[model samples]
Structures are given as structure tokens and as C-alpha cells.
Target: MKLSDFKEGALGGVPIALGYLSVSFAYGIMAAGGGIDPLSAVLISMTNLTSAGQLAGTQLIIDGATYFQIAVTTLVINLRYMLMSLSLSQRIDPKMSTGERLLVSYGITDEIFAVAYQREKAPNTPYMLGLISLPYVGWTLGTLLGATAGNILPERLCSALGIAIYGMFVAIVIPQCRKSHPCLVVVAVAAALSCLLKYVPVLSSVPTGWAIIICTVAASVLGAVLYPEEVDEV
Candidate 1:
């Protein structure tokens, strides 16, 4: 929790924040276009920092979805947070207060989790706090500005930027998958199942949120069972 540790964490986190800021800008424009208020857009980016869940939730809102549907969809889309939280909890100081844990949890995201987990030594509480704060600030500010200027952007340009966030997701996930056979299998299975669900008669009407949950869970479980971590030969 020392000042030097906090500065180091911020330095470590700068690259991640820069990448996230760009993706979040697109999310802000989408949220605004979907009728979310500017403040709400900023809040979502600041609190959730989850592009897919935010996009799904915002579209559901624009479609006049029931409150229950929005809640369920968001939970399904964000289920991975549970795993990330569990991993991060292990890295945090054992003496850390529950309140500190709760506050840091708000900033958990794929990129943040990856960087934190990869660190050789666990980050101190102050460092984690600073790491979270910098990106959260960028996300909030980007969302506020994007929402305010959403209408002024040309439609084609906005659409292209919107696609960039998904590209970022692919860029992160694909490299990790390439390095692990089990991960590759899981991704392939999920893609196949998703495609089938989209084209099959009865499943075609299933809620996309539910379909994604089912596919992801099934694939991950299969991957874990079929490809348990390799052990070196004696």
C-alpha cells in the first residue's frame, strides 16, 4: 500500500488503460445511440467496464425489454466475472478488509485480471486501487464525451468504430487459445454450437443471452474435463 507501489501499478497498467479507452469510446457511442443517458453511459463504463454486457443491456433497453430480461441477460453475459473475482481474491492481501475487496471488485475486467494475475508478486492494496482508478477514469471520461458527440459522427464512421471493440475482444482471446489445445477445442465447440443454435428451427427463437450462456458453459466444462493440465513425465 505504499506510494511507490501504487505508482508502479499505475505504470504497469498504462498500456491496458490506453487500449481500453479506445474500445470504451465505441461503447459510449453505441449506448448513447441506443437511448442511454450520457451519465448512465459513463456510469456503466466506469462500473462495469464490460463492453459485451453493456452493449447487450443497452440494446435490450432500447427494445423495451422487461426489467427481468435485462437483469438475466446482463448476469449471463457477465458470468465470467465470478471466475476473475475468485482469482483476484487469491492474489490480494489476506489482511485486506472486506470493504477494500468490495471496492476493488468494481474495477475487475478481462484485461485488468490478466495483468494482475501475470504479476510475479501480488499487487498491494494501494497499487490495485490506483491501477483500477486510472482506467475507470478514462472509461468514464470517454463515455461522457462519446455520448455527448454521438449524434455528430457520420453513421458509417460510427459503425466502423463500433466493430473495433469486438475486434479487441477477439485479439485478446485468440492468442491465448492458440497456445492451449484445450482452449482451442472449447472455442471451436462453442462456435459450432452457437452456429447450430442460430440456424436450427426450435433454437432459432431462443434468447441470445441464454444461448451464449449454454454454449460457453458447456464448452468450458468439456475443455476442462477433456484436457486437464498436462503433467510432465518423470
Candidate 2:
């Protein structure tokens, strides 16, 4: 609960907050274009804190998909968060209470997890709270701005900004891929599988959410099998 710890956490989260703002802005545009109101879109960002899940869910809503479909699709797309949460649990200060841990879990996005996990020791509750706060606010505000802008912005401009989310993803992964052969392989395999799923006759009929799940799992397993690292040595 130290002020210094909280300040450090907030400072560490600034980059992540900036990234979330750009990405969530794109999500807001997409949501608004699909007929979601600004408030609803902002609320979705506040509650979900997931890019893929929110985007897929918004698309499903536009398509008039059943509740069951929305639930399953979101669950499939967000299954990685389960593993992230488990990993983060091991990195949280053991003195944190159950309630505090649950609160911290809400902020455990991929970027946050990466930063928190790299710390020399487990992150205490105050640090985690500070880290999550700014990003959460940024994401919610970005969605609000995007949604409001989507309603008034020119069609061409909105269309152009639609690519922002993908661009962000590329920005995140390309550096790591360049540094690691295994990472590159995984990305390539996932891209190829995604393309195949989009083009192949039978597979093309599968929902986009399922396609993503299959591609991610298949490529990840392939990468793990191909590059079994020496864990103890590391």
C-alpha cells in the first residue's frame, strides 16, 4: 500500500495504457459501426478488457447470434486468459488476500502479465492496483471516443482506422518474432492456418471464432513440440 509502490506500478503501466487506447479505439469504431451505442461499447471495454473477445462478440451481436453462440465464442477466444491468470497467480505477492487477488485478476491482460512477470519478485497488491488502474481508464475512454467518433466520422476515415487493431497486433509480435526463430515459426504457422481456414471449402464454413481458436491452438502446439526448450537450464 506504499505510495511509492503505487507510483511505480502506475509508471510501468503507461505504455500499456497507451497501447490499449489505440487498440480499443479501433474496437469502439467497429462496435459503433455494428450498431452498438457508445455507452454499451465503453461498458464492454470496461468489463471484458479483451480485444479479441470483445471484437468477436460485437460481430456476433451484429449477426444476431444466439446467446449460446456468443458465450461459447467468447469463451473459446478468451481461454488463454485462464492460463494467464494461473501464471500470474504464482507471481502475485503471497500475502495478498483472496479478495485482492480476485481484483488483480481482472486486470491480467497479456501485456500486463508480461510486465508483471518480468519483475524480480512477486508484485504486491498496491503495485498491481496502480498498474491496472490507468490502463482500465484508458481503454474505457478510448472506446468512448471511438464510438462517438464512429457515429460522426466520414465513412472512408472510419474504414481506414479499422486496420489499427491489426497494426497494433503486428507491432506487438513482430519484434519478438524477429528475435526468436520459434516465435517466427509460430506466427507463420498461425497465419497459414488462418488463411487455410478462410479459403478451404469446408473449413470456410466454420465460424471465425472457431477458426481463430483452431489456428492458435494448433500453431502453439506445433511450436512447443518443435522447440522444446531446456527449462532447468534457463
The best candidate by TM-score is 2
Worst 10 residues of 1 by lDDT: 225-234
Please provide TM-scores, in order, for all candidate models, with all chains considered together. 0.86, 0.87
Candidate 2's C-alpha runs over 4 A off are: 230-234
Pick the lDDT winner.
2
- Model 2's number of clashes is 0
| 181-202 per-residue lDDT for model 1 (tens digits) | 6777888999999998899999
Candidate 2 lDDT over 29-145, as tens digits, reads: 999888999999998999999887888888888888778878988888788788878878777888999999878899988788888878776899888888888899889989999
> What residue pairs are clashing in model 1?
none
Estimate the TM-score for candidate 2.
0.87
What is the clash count for each candidate, in the order shown?
A: 0, 0
